[model samples]
Target: MRCNVAPHTFRSSPYFHLTRPLTRRSLKSIEDGLINAQHLDDQIPTELAPGNAAVLIPLANVMDVPGILLEVRGKMMRNHSGEVSFPGGRVDATDSSYVEAALRETREELGIGAQDIEILGQIGPPEVNLRGNMVVYPFVGFVHAGSSHSDHTNTVALDEPLPSCDLDAIRRNASQTEVDAVFHLPLSALTSPARLRASMFRGNRPYWAIGVQDLVSDIPASFKGRMKQIEHDDVDDSEIGPGKYGNLEVWGLTGWYLYLLMKKLKLYY
Candidate 1:
């Protein structure tokens, strides 16, 4: 891993040229920027106030590349059932800060804890959506897997740790009660031209969405069929609500935050 590579160099890096393989050096650079980055004040809408909700964007510690964790909400979920999203929920009153809320929700949903995460930074200013009457703060963090870096790994097992950073491990770790399925998306694929499509919400607001093929291998059998159903142009009706970008639809306010995150990482323009 190159210790001194700058984020700007990513534009010309071999990583992008070779089918979007994310290297450790590239992830390190992203982490460095996030730690020191200022909040995105302008991007956050002002109509809504800071609320008691947050989400964790968890990046994994794969050797050559890192992957992000996402959840498919259980079919029984009251809101957004079977939807893909970051692992998080409304902040509890006992929680001290938004960070704690994120970690706690992650623990409840994915079995990840604050001890396992090295918080890079909050991706954007608090996200405020008038439609849902919610304001959510987004936290970017890394979950250490094994012995790569002692400082990064949480050796003290707090409750049985969710071992194995593989695809199957991610799927098995997801709580059946909360998550229908779990999948890991390589950081590189988030910005791939072939995997991205420009989508519009409310027939005006535009954001980027990811295609099913962009997923980092091992998609569940159930999700594959849904992905194919949404791959075409039949569900473009804004009046019907959020549109899918293949099966893994990343849209609505969640899509907005994803766009902000991609820009923050210099992965997407």
Candidate 2:
């Protein structure tokens, strides 16, 4: 379920300066972190049958710029509408494993198939009872933008590479019904020390979260106050967003994922 591109190949690409290889040590750490996260295990309850869900953390060198694939959900959706997120949804009963559900949801959301992706493995245990509705399983993997084809066959290669910032290749294959737009943020952006900031919850279980400043600047002045409201309540769209800012809004669970992944890659401490 995993695939590896030659380290030299990734290094030689135009995006080499912006991207680093996902090393074996980091991959092992990611798996170990998830497996050993006692806090994640504690979130599940014995009586509740967790509603399983999965998401794919797809990374790739697109037109020589290494970036991660993310989706802007359609505004008409019932939940998390118009939010940026990894491609995935609930694991249907027919699915055999978390891997299957992740790949299936990815295919449904982005038209990406198992053949095009090299599944790296799981990250952390299922983030259980999220918003009190479902348990989410996150998987990290590599996606090759050059290998994309309308038919899901690997034979077709692009006549010309896409521009580094363009997302048309991915958008062309995405499901318009579920996705309003598709975008890629250079993986290099997350490692910047200056753009990152942190805030303390200062509650009973006081914790700190890292976020990109200016990314959520439009959030109402009451944003921190709202935190107290939902600190122990089920999440709803009313609490979904301060909305997207110009720069990619990588925060909350998604930001935490980047923090852990980048830390494991040794890009950040």
Candidate 3:
């Protein structure tokens, strides 16, 4: 199937684009900025293991509204039940590489075929949750423009409504699960100040916030109320409420990956 998403306007912020090529001096400057900003914590022990996993960050083309595709797992699933995440799983013996595993699982979960996706690059190898100490390799892939899939497919028909939006789906999915929900947040969100905030959590508690940019001022009142209700419920369970304007406080491995990616790309605002 061909992905037929509309084209969304994406601009590179002046803050994000460096004037010169990244040299050792420039790299050191960037690292120093992060260190001085107190964003680096070297105390956490690095846990590297052999288990492999993968996830596809599916991008849809929408006019002035590029978005990432995200899935909400059935609550009955064994691990990360009801969590909002990218469609992926552990590497099977038949899978040749982590990239292959990601593409295959995305095909299985979203009815997105291997031929329809263009692999961009990788982000990180974070720790996996349920698979007895497995490392997850996340790859960025772009769904072919104008691609279309049917409702009759086994994947889309079984999963709940697959939302494609600018970071809103991430917040909504995380709010529903009350656990660390995986997300491929847009680079645009990290460029604005009003849409971003820094959060501090209890000792070693992973916490970071990714604010949304260019949000419509008049969001439907009903949707706003529903979001409040979801936040209230999550708060009762000791999880942070859905953040301002329905943005999420990314935590755990998700937050770590985002942090690292932002640092590496020098894109954080």
Candidate 4:
């Protein structure tokens, strides 16, 4: 397995609020400045791992607020059930490039077509998932829901604390067998220092986690029945609220990648 990147330094910043209300323009400003990950020497080096996979950090303007798109794997999924994640999966043998593999997974998992996504570039310092015995490559891309796309709904997820978007039409293309719900998290919410923290998993391995504070109810019923774990940190985080409760944290590889992405944009709090 490849070595992991050391965690970046976290510092208090008076400049945090200035990035809000994150907009298309502000994110686009740094597009050209980002490191270019794809290359003319395009072999995926799948030899580095027994398996290969890719995921896209989807960027979109949902409800006119620019943010990242995420998903919850179906309850019946073989692994990582009820967890929030980006749309992607294992790289296929026929896949010519990691970019294509990432695009295909997004289309299959979210119904967002390749044509709708403008590939920004690949994300660097690829992750090696020892449990899966594979290398996972991530890419940054922009997604534009066309006029034919379903009407937008309010976003949901701990990253931005949105209720799940339930637009029927927009999800027509998504493979419900694999995906339980879709969410668009505002960049500002993800960058909010109050929502982000460092935590230990199970007991020993320390990882970064984002606190949503939403109850188990914020997620789908299917996920609720299959739920196996609940974790909450932060004294200020509420434990009880009406019929709805909160606290779906993002940790492990997902949290790490989010840190890397947000750090790249100078949005990490």
Candidate 5:
């Protein structure tokens, strides 16, 4: 269920000169380097929403490019439509754990099966989205190449970089009302503060809204020219710091969680 954004209309923002060129990182290095991973069983505040949800902070390599996976919610959804968010949904009573719930949602929304995901750990505490009145528990999962699907046993493959991780192979959910688009935002660009901007206003109130433009360039050239990303994104005249950032703004609870992930991973000094 992907909508075509016109080719000539995506806003052209100034690009930041990255100190180093973006390259695929070694998965083993990342796993060994990860710290401050929280326990997945941490409690959730059920009162924050009718039913809390578990979201996957999916990290994978797509077409040889390593990055985090995100989605554009379809406008007709019950909540959080037309927004950028990790793949997830409300936790069902049958769910064994938030980890299970997150993986389940990843399968439903992105068509990736549980065998392809390697659960790293939780990100932090559950985030409360006042706009959606939703409480979401975020978990980090490293997606592996389809050829190396976990036996759900020995995980020796995760000890090294498996170049086969590809999202293009999965069949996308065909329902337009559920997910409009699924794209991976590169981690290298995501780590640099120079490559990101935080808008300070939503309406008249103050907030730290992050706008990430890195993925704009990642979009295939043929389709990027016509998409007015910020238009559907609902960006106002709020300041986005000193330099230009891409129009793919991450606002509300998603923005808050993303900022925390950056700090937790220590992706940048």
Candidate 6:
């Protein structure tokens, strides 16, 4: 769908300057380099069922800056229960493709329509297993800042504004069973290495890193080697531990998924 913003508005944004010249070859090179550079995917357990799907990592401009939209599932929901996650679900019979599934789910979950979103290419698909049965497909989409949509039309109402909810609610809602929450990390954080750190979680539990393509440059060489060692290590004796950094606790599939996404996206430091 086309955005309503004027062409002149694009001149002031960094995206226009930074992404305008990205040719197919360069984009492919970046994607291919990520695929070959790490063994993050080796960390996911093979027992999970594979399923086709998609998720929109919604980006909205807030205060002239880009931020992601995330949702805290209702406490009563089954499966992940109240955990944080993007607005997405498994591909269904009516869906045409992964992208279509993501868009449809987003509309259902957030009450945002397809016309409001700007498809800025895919961030590719990352695998996530839910309830030991389904492998999730994730796609990233961007929406301009100052964009607004009405969720009131839907059966459920998302009363909180996306940005305000991120700062006030996401962390507070996290707990053992109802611990699902989602929040957007700034793009600057994705490109910078200064904020990245190697974290050992939950009694020094070792997790298989699956998604590290976006944050590879920020990782230290020593840590990279250690990760490689962990990947090849046997899983028999490993224990789950608390996260070494950040408020996030790394345990179960959730931690593993986070590690994979960060590793694949290279969103460290």
Cα lDDT of model 4 by residue, 1-269, tens digit: 11222354454332223334333343344455355323443234544232678889887665655567777777777777766777787877767777888899998888877776766656557666646477778888777556221221222221332122233444566778887777666665564556655554333434356664342224765556544433344222111111112345665566666666666555543
Worst 10 residues of 1 by lDDT: 1-10
TM-score of 4: 0.69
TM-score, candidate number 6: 0.46
- Give the alpha carbon lDDT tens digit for every residue of 1-269 in model 6: 11121222111221221212222233234345445544544332323233655667665544333445555444445544433356677677777676778888877766556765555444423544433455565555544222433331232223222222233333343332332344444434333334433333332434332122232223322222223222322231212122222122223444344444444544321
Worst 10 residues of 5 by lDDT: 9-18
Error of 4 at 25 (Å): 5.1
What's the best-to-worst order under lDDT? 1, 4, 5, 2, 3, 6
Which should have the higher TM-score, number 3 or number 4?
Answer: 4
Candidate 2 deviant stretches above 4 angstroms = 1-17, 20-50, 146-166, 199-248
Per-residue C-alpha lDDT of model 5 across residues 21-71, encoded as one tens digit per residue: 112234333444444344444444333333778888877767656577777
> What TM-score does each of the candidates earn?
0.70, 0.62, 0.51, 0.69, 0.66, 0.46
Considering TM-score, where higher is better, how would the candidates rank from best to worst?
1, 4, 5, 2, 3, 6
CA lDDT scores, all candidates in order:
0.59, 0.52, 0.45, 0.57, 0.55, 0.41
lDDT string, candidate 2, 109-175, tens digits: 8888777676655555455434667776677776644444223233423332222323576677888
Q: Which model, 4 or 6, shows the larger TM-score?
A: 4
Q: Candidate 6 local accuracy as lDDT?
A: 0.41
Off by over 4 Å in 6: 1-52, 123-125, 128-132, 145-184, 188-269
Poorest lDDT segment (10 consecutive residues) of candidate 3: 231-240
Report per-prediction Cα RMSD to one decimal: 8.2, 10.1, 13.3, 8.8, 9.4, 14.1
Best by TM-score: 1
Q: Which stretches of candidate 1 lie over 4 Å from their true place?
A: 1-28, 35-37, 40-51, 130-132, 146-150, 153-164, 201-205, 213-242
The candidate that wins on lDDT is: 1
- Model 3 accuracy (lDDT, Cα): 0.45
Per-residue lDDT tens digits of candidate 3, residues 1-269? 12121222123422223222222233234335434433233221233224666767665433323345554444445564433356787778777777888898876666567776656455643444533466566666555432333221224322222223334433443433222233444445544445444442222332344443223233333223324333221211112233443443333344445544554445532
Residue 215 alpha-carbon offset, candidate 3, angstroms: 9.9
